[model samples]
Target: MATSPTTTGPRAPAGPGKDDRLTPRGKLALSLLCAAQFIIALDFSILNVALPVLGDDLHMRQADLQWAVTAFALPSGGFLLLFGRIADLFGRRRLFIAGLVLFTLASVLATAAWGLAPFLIARALQGLGAAAVVPTGMSLLTTTFPEGPQRNKALAVSGTILSLGYTVGMLLGGVMTDQLGWRSTMALLAAAGGIVAIAAPALLTDSRPTERPKLDIPGAVTVTGGLLCVIYALSTAADQGFGGLDVIATLVVGVLLLAAFVVVELRVAQPLVSLQMLRRPTVAFGNLGGLTTFSMMSSVIFLLTLYLQDVLGLSAFETSLVFAVQGAVLVGTGTAASRIVAALGARTTLVAGLTVQSVFTAALLFLSGDDDVWLAVTALALASVGHMSAVVSYGINATSGLPDNAQGLATGLVTSAQQLGITIGIPVLSAFAASRVGSLERAGEDARTALLGGTRTGVGVDAALVLVSVLLIGFGLRRADRR
Candidate 1:
């Protein structure tokens, strides 16, 4: 259980032979990490702008389109903890580089894909690569920067870049899909990945546990399979109705498997995630709070995109421009969030952000079919601010209390929770909307009328989720501060 020497504290002032003024090497490493984060974040939004184009070009059905998105999300969500533990046992640097390479290759394959199956397979590979990169990068940051101001600042910069990446991705995806084509967007991402891969080897120092533990195979299988099943079921429910037998069965099996995972972790010598860490008020509450906030945020974006295009009749380019407003606010707020957290404390800042977010979410429910565009945009922008602020605060707090060596697992768990929230949120909310729409249709409503009613119902459900998230965050803040 030996820790890296760097985790000890500030080292002696470097002499001429040892230069360390945020050495070129360190800067390069940070750059690679930031680029990796940007690419991963970009993947989340890039497809939004390209989906229509991809569908038209490939003759894809609606179900195929849904799979295109879910294919990436499910694997990324399912494999994070397993890969994070792998990174800890093997080498973070090695895994990070390998992930970069794999992602880049996947992007190339996707660019060349002429069929639905190939494209989806490529996306799944990209997801697997992302699973490796995120945890490894976080682990590297945690190991490189000792706990305190330096680590906090590093996390701040990383978080800001991550948010900015999402904004840039949406804008770029729109422009590229409109002008150059969807395939070109994949090529661009591949190029970015290549750049990261080239820089990673020189900048990242290989590190491994002095005494590595055995791989928790049973825990890994149970958790990964369980999460995959859950995500698959939820995604299925979105496409097929809530009463779909396959969806219900998959969800039931997933729950049971996850319960088995917990039991396995408790009895194993080296658990994939240490149950003891979850006992910590800061870690546990921060995760729950993050889960709630991300779930609402993810579902809101999904519903809003459909509403803007289908209900409001906005074009793709125009819709993307509107989405960019929220991205701008998110980046602006996220940059300053760390300083705000420092000044006000994590609990205060988180609570404030969550409360504001809830207010904005509720406000969206009042938007009528005839509402002004400015009003809708303003509400979305406010929600983005709150979402980004809370996310940054949670990221900082989640890693603060754990011992240095456990930071990778903590980061992975946090990321997994956020993904799980989104995975669960999209299907659940989509199902609510679809059911409501069905009821309205059964009442003899027209298709267009049903869609409008469904969109409103979806918005209402999202607002409710936001309110619940706010309450959970408030509870988490209180619990953490008391500890």
Candidate 2:
């Protein structure tokens, strides 16, 4: 195999004469990639609304019901980086198509599952497929479109579809579970996956680096094991809190294994990921921005779900309607994200987006029992504009100035930040709210009011964290963006 030295250093933007327009093939490619992304996002959330109904039907214990969600999340979050690297070495398109087959088959299995054990196994297989698809799809996009306005626009569209998929899944899950039964939710995923799998081969071109560098076995094992442990521990913490012996022990082991992975990568000749890539301001701050926006925003949604349903007495469908508003706002924002990056550059767009998100999220502090729940809806809608813009810009920033050969590694970090953010957000932030609720209850407050207080505090903290991140990311990336 022919080899070129890998370089992740900063590079100048495309010259004025370079054509930034997309051809017809580009449009079709974008459509296929976006479809894959939508299915991945949909699978992540579609099961939430159907969980209780599915649990009763399957005769699952209440304590074990959370596993339905965790089982999918674990492999999806844990194996992202490893599979991402594999896609680069083996073949992105090949792995992507293979992932679709696995995902589609798993969905069918989940739909036809006769009991709890089979269902959980099928869900894990679905997650494993998702692990392969997400990063590979992203890398394909990055490779398909050059690093410029064209790629930025494509990413904006992809990110918008991702947000819409989650929202639609929430709403669709409720309607499907109510009208067609809980199994119908899994069937829907199977149908969507089948369609995408059939289309993927023709639409996607095979891509891999010229150099077939040896896979870093020690690094891959340690990192994959570390991530699995941490994700499992965090998922358990979400339900059981951080006080459980198992959760604490798992977290400790996870951290130690991750530390060892870092050490192994440093010594290995063909490291799974180049630590020096982290030295690039765009990669470093971009991942940081992505992690914060995703984590904090997701935490806010989880908090609102409980508050709206438990405290305000809204039905599941009604709560979905409130989120639908945010989805609409994101759609509008996505249309403008590329233009915003064109005008302000990715770094400024990122900082400005986070600032806007923080300001509106702060508005949620005014929320109380007396106020209309629409107050929460309004805040989220405004915040989502920032959310969508940040999503687009962080992606551009992260993948900027890297060689095509390293695009997979760059996108792996990008997708991993996103996956881990979503996984870690609910547990960590909800724990804060839970603590506040416990303290208030101990102080003789009523259950409803105490819960309300806890939710408010959690929202406030989320706002503050995002606000602080604005400064950190801005300063960190100041030198990275010269445009």
Candidate 3:
């Protein structure tokens, strides 16, 4: 086993006593960490509203617009595990600050872009920075807050703020795209990242592993390559078809590289990800549960956004408002999550939350060309509440029992699950829904009706995914009880 960081580095301070609720230092830590997360969240949602506007402004097609997102997502998703391990070996604070600076600089470059290449390059740079920041910031949070209710409360706040950022980004992206230009989204992120950067050094202390493990060169190389290939494959599959030779080949290579990565990790003295860590029940199930929750939640957002704008002909601003309400629901539920988790246990909470999300997603099947809107809107809001609650509970489960040095890996695992899920889910589910639409259209349905029907189909599939998670958790909990 790897050595603990008791004497070697600035490990997280002991948990705050009840008497010290939101002390000055605690507030500062929370503020700083949350701020980083808030900015990252902003970047993710901001682009969704702006993609069309960007395609027009840059004189690019939908293909190029997808690239703009893929450029960012590839590095961010691909390099997360590697960067998380690096943060553990080197210093979490060091990587966190560095990533922030890099992200801000790229945002500036993106904001000033005049054409496709510069914009795509800048977005990729931002992703590289994000790959470092997400896990390291999360590591800092786990270490700073301690592993109990205090940490749960802090994570709830982070999840709430993060969900709020997505809401804000949607509204902001629409307003900015309408009033100024799509570039304004990047400008907004740059401004937010700057403020967080200034506050971070003052609030965060450096924490590194006690005995630095030699970088697992093969593990890092193979895993990074594998993830990059996988993300590329997913993006390609989403854009093109799975039948495309390119997508199939890329996906095959990704699977092979990942297999190689696992073998290397097992053989090596210092592994990028400790396979032993993956054996933890909470860690394993937390990520699987979280993956289903996030993927399904994000798929709902993607399909609904398209249905609202493309099918129902709602303006981007109006669509943003609808999602804004959902965001509020998420924030509210997140606020109450700590109490719920304490009372119910993370496992129980996870099951309940997943069940709620599944039910609401299934409710979307009630939506049709009738454009009642209430069915879609109500279900979305309720689903957001459950989704955010799951996020908090999963964060607690994944990191709760992890040691200080392993915090980076724990957080990285969950974060990777989220990114990969979003990346994979939107495409897979969307394709299924699109197929349904095609079938209906071939059978003589109107375009609007086909779109509405397609979105409903996607929502149904999303519900199925969440329901599967519920069953998985229920089964696992039953096994644990038997033991």
Give every collision pair in model 3.
none
Best by lDDT: 2
Please give, for residues 1-483, the per-residue lDDT of candidate 3 as tens digits: 232544243323444443224557877888888888888878877888778879998889877678877898899999999998898889888999999999999999999998888999999999999999989988887777667767788888987887677667778888888898888889988988888888888888887665877999999999999999988888877667788899899999999999999999899998998999887777888888888887888789889888888887888777877887898788789889888888898888888888999999999888766675777789999888788878888888888767777888899997888777766777788778878888999999998888888898898888988998889877875675576
lDDT of 2 at 148: 79
> What residue pairs clash in candidate 2, if any at all?
none
lDDT of 2 by residue, 151-201 (tens): 888899998998778778888888999999988988988998899889988
Which 10-residue window in model 1 sums to the lowest lDDT? 9-18
Task: Quote the lDDT for 345 in model 3.
Answer: 87
lDDT of 1 by residue, 332-410 (tens): 8876776787787776666677777778877777655563467678988998788777777777777776765577788
User: Backbone clashes in each candidate structure, one number apiece?
Assistant: 0, 0, 0
Instruction: List per-candidate RMSD values in Å.
Output: 3.6, 3.3, 2.3
Measured with C-alpha atoms, the lDDT of residue 12 in candidate 1 is: 22
- What C-alpha lDDT do the candidate models reach, one value each? 0.78, 0.87, 0.83
lDDT of 1: 0.78
Q: How does each model score on TM-score?
A: 0.92, 0.95, 0.95
Sliding window of 10 residues with minimal summed lDDT for model 3: 1-10
The TM-score of candidate 1 is 0.92
